[model samples]
Target: MPKVSKHLNAANLIDQVCKCLDEIPDHRPNHCPNGIPFPNFAKSAFAMMHQKYDSLLTFDSDRADPVILHNLATMYHVQDQKVPCDTRMREVLDPIEPAQFRKPFKKLFSLIQRNKLLKAFEYQCGDLKDWYLMPVDGTGLFYSGKCRCQECCVKNKGKPNEAYYHNLLGGCIVHPDQKVVMPFAPEAIVQQDGDNKNDCEQNAIKRYLAHVKREHPHLKLVILLDGLFADNPTIELIKSYGWHFIIVAKDGNHKSLIEAMDALCDQEQLSYHKIIDEEQGTRHWFRFANDVPLNASKLTQNVNVLDYVETDSEGKRHTWCWVTDIELTKDTVEAVMRGGRCRWHIENQTFNTLKNQGYSLEHNYGHGKQHLATNLAYLTFLAFMVDQIQEMASPEFKKALKERARGVRTYLWKVITRVFLSWMLEGWDELFDALIYGIKPGRVQINTS
Candidate 1:
């Protein structure tokens, strides 16, 4: 099998995705002579996601233009295409399984690994070295009192009213210092059967973890998780996969574990370390105990408990506590604390950017009876992954982003879309050149011949 190219740019990445979509078998009725090919419909939908169009109606309107049609053919590789109307596009995409979209994510990650882009993400601490930190969390994508499909999870609020919502368990590779996060495939927390039981985050997490391990069995992962995942079963699952973890442990939830650590500290059996940075007017205190039991029932499941408190010149203080399989030492405790705290990036960088920064993750694009909403979310995340890759690797994109005023991403997107629509460009390099250096190609003309 041929490897994905080491020198892939945004255009080449999209082209590779087009090839992957072309391979997904279209299950539309065979007798329908007018059915759009799945790849063309998928590519068009991805274009909307790539450009951050708010609605299918707006995307369909833009797709009606001859210039847009030509661009779709040349740039995205849509084939034999009359632009499908919004309704038709939804109908076509509804039945397609969302899992199929994960292929491109895996492929792109492989390319990054092969090209040595992942080296920058390797985290180093005390005795631990060269492990990638993957933070996992869940978020609500859609919520309503009225709209819902079969997949929506319903919550009855002890009244005549019910809240229907869609939730997704998202995980991302992160670093303590880097702002960019590379999201992995997300698992939908929804109704699996017609049963009364609604799916949940913990259940979704088990599925997500299994999927991640199955997909990348050999990748050295140090899983970072929140207080919700500090339970015995989840920790056991992480251990069973031969992966390391640093999970938030709160006194309220893990009282027994906290008490055990406190007892060890009173006996002076645990290690204590402190640092005061006079220049920054901050004091750091760390305490750690090894061979600590996680809970009453799981005494055999030993873990390392580490906690830190930081005090500033104003006398305000902040504290964090975590449980990890990795041993805590004087040299390694601070790095472990940083890794544990960086788990919030899954929310701040990945979910927030998707929801607030013009990706319109919560907007109701299409809610088909089957998989349309989930599929669209997957495609949108794929677009985000591409943008993140460019942010890390593309100097031209970096230059354009730096020159963008006020650092408003939506405005930058507008400029890029306008350039894409107005000019005839060969690839992403030309697009970035135009944005960075004010170079313009001749306006694209509709070929009437």
Candidate 2:
């Protein structure tokens, strides 16, 4: 254990976040031989996002304005220095392809794994009792009333009768102890002319699986999914990709399939039971069903099922279910239940954080007639990953955060606002000194020269 505490020391984490930005090719130079130094766009963006999440700042960049602002945030509070009024920020992001932005997501996964932040997932799924469990799902983030670009998914409305939607198929490896769910590259679901639309979730899953395998052939994962993905073809496809699955199996969705499972269970054919206690003050009773025929049709594959009933503090009884590729046993039921329940982490941890936390994922920062919407969303997610990593791994930054005592966004906004007021602070260290050493505002000279 790394002696976990509440105070967040996020500088090293900030450094890590900056490194992700470094992976991006900077066209601007530092001098004649090196050109002018590239502006710290990553830090500025992160700072802005952090403030936005804290509800302390807002900038109106309607026609690609350069200077960011805060109606309530003071000039002395500004952290990011203003750049020349060039449309370069938008131009720089405009041409960058979406595929190139996706590279950082993979880097995030590698960094978490290397730093042991993801160690909590060592064995939460039964199939890989020693490996991690990754569940894949898809979601749509941007939708527009106008036909934005060629890659847009079009839909017909009542009057205007036209719109564009952007969606991504996302996947994450989940574990009982991990607070943040690690997300993979999202496959865009778009539309095309003369075609019904672009790929749906089913096809997206197929391509995503292939991509994951091509990249991490030896990685161990047990895919968990909704009942929509419990069919034979999907199962076979998953198995072929060399991954395990724990999909939802509802009696209503698969009537014949559940009937077969019931018959087998009644015959005392390899069925078992177990009880579990969750950290969230919930109790779960699990009924394990294994090697049961998934379909009554000609094509059937034997799969494992775990039917669970949970009772929470409010005395609400919730019925849940899952089908897995792992064999059911007394030793594995607890792990199965954990993987099944952690499915909510993707929605709660990943998507919710992106929406409610500082990322403002749903907010329309830029709705370019081209790829601006999707590109901005990617940038926000990248910033979010950096924040989560800092919260989980960085110690010094965490401590400074604790002393600040406010939320991450609030503290960051104060820093940014202070910078804009032309305070004497040179770097984060001087800023921290001003905050801690009680250097009153306007009492010191900010050495911009």
Candidate 3:
């Protein structure tokens, strides 16, 4: 049995979180000074998302069990064995800015970088060295018609009572072959302090990039994005940061650009490369051109275009087109295309896992008058980062994943919740050890006599 690295185990990771969130400035009014410490409030709230509990009430119920309370103290660094009630926790945390959560994410990411765990996610090509593939996109947080708060963005579309929703522009360091994604700090798209118009994805992305610049200015990134981000301003923002981008370009959205590609194809200016594999019975093709204007404007920005198509043994074909800054040679086109196509990983593996797998990301945990909903989203994303971090580095977590259900997180979270509730864990090590080995081979037989 290999020992999990001191820097990589689950308890050590959550303890790092404890050290960060422990400094969350006290927002409670001085009139009521008997409130629980901010660490307990913050981490107890985070525990709900980490354990995949559906509601604040559900997670709060565990406070009744002394053994579970002990485990919470042992595992999550919950101070004083006291988990706050749902209402108290929400009340205490609501006023604190969601930005506070970014600290833990930066700390965790620093660990990954300093310990060389991010090497598995690196993408390199000509002139692009030690760069990570980061997929950037937006996803909807929960929405409601009746539970409106000052923070919600309204979508009326000519209706009297507008439906309110929250969204986040998220980015993650990703790889085509890996299922686990290391997420960046998520940006909440909500009404600004004094803005009259509804908030938007473009504005959220601007803030997201600002935060990325402030937090991690040195890392080289190849940003993978969808058609919505193919516009001029988004293009210029990425370029301003000196980072590279590969964005999907649809004909309907970028008519002038696609027409330019077609014109070049007619003139036979495009270079084509194909790789056919007899073992897989498939053919991969790349056609590319460089130094084309992104639009018909006289001063429009220029990009390199690469079109990819894959043909199966049955002759069925699928195609994708992208515009990027990378110089697209025969060798480089395929790697850039893979990076472009891997943008879907943010939607499939990260967001889908949060929405459907068990995190209940869209569920309304609490909609406080202040920052409850947004902070809850941050907590959920943080929980996901912890799980992803363990998947990347922890041997014990890997072992438990195999012993339980072969890396299925839903099963892993479920058994961890049940076992921690039923038994006492001195730390995460014992729990994972119990899971890696057998908890019990067989239960006692029921007697009807």
Q: How far does residue 110 in candidate 1 sit from its true spot (Å)? A: 0.6
- The digit string of per-residue lDDT tens for model 2 on 285-375 reads 7777667778787668888777878888777999877888887788787777777777777777887777765467777655555565566
List the candidate 3 regions with Cα displacement exceeding 4 Å: 1-4, 31-33, 193-199, 440-449
What tens-digit string does per-residue lDDT give for candidate 3 at 1-449? 22346688798889988899998887666734564667788888787788888988888777878787888888888887778888888788888899899999999999888778878887878778789999888888878877777678777645877787788878899988888899988988887622323237767777888789779999888888888778788889899998999999898878998888999999999999998989989999998999999998887899999989999999999999999999999879878877887999999989999899988889999998878898999999999999888877888888788878786878888998888888778999899988888677677565798
For residues 40-124, write the lDDT of model 1, one tens digit per residue.
8788888888888889988878886766777777777877756678998898888898888889889888867777777788899
Order the candidates by TM-score, highest first — what do you get? 3, 1, 2
Indicate which candidate wins on TM-score.
3
For each candidate in turn, the TM-score is 0.91, 0.76, 0.94
Where is model 2 more than 4 Å wrong at Cα? 1-88, 124-129, 157-160, 192-199, 265-270, 276-283, 406-449
lDDT of each: 0.82, 0.61, 0.85
Candidate with the greatest lDDT versus the true structure:
3
Model 1 quality (TM-score): 0.91
Question: How would you order the candidates by lDDT, starting with the best?
Answer: 3, 1, 2
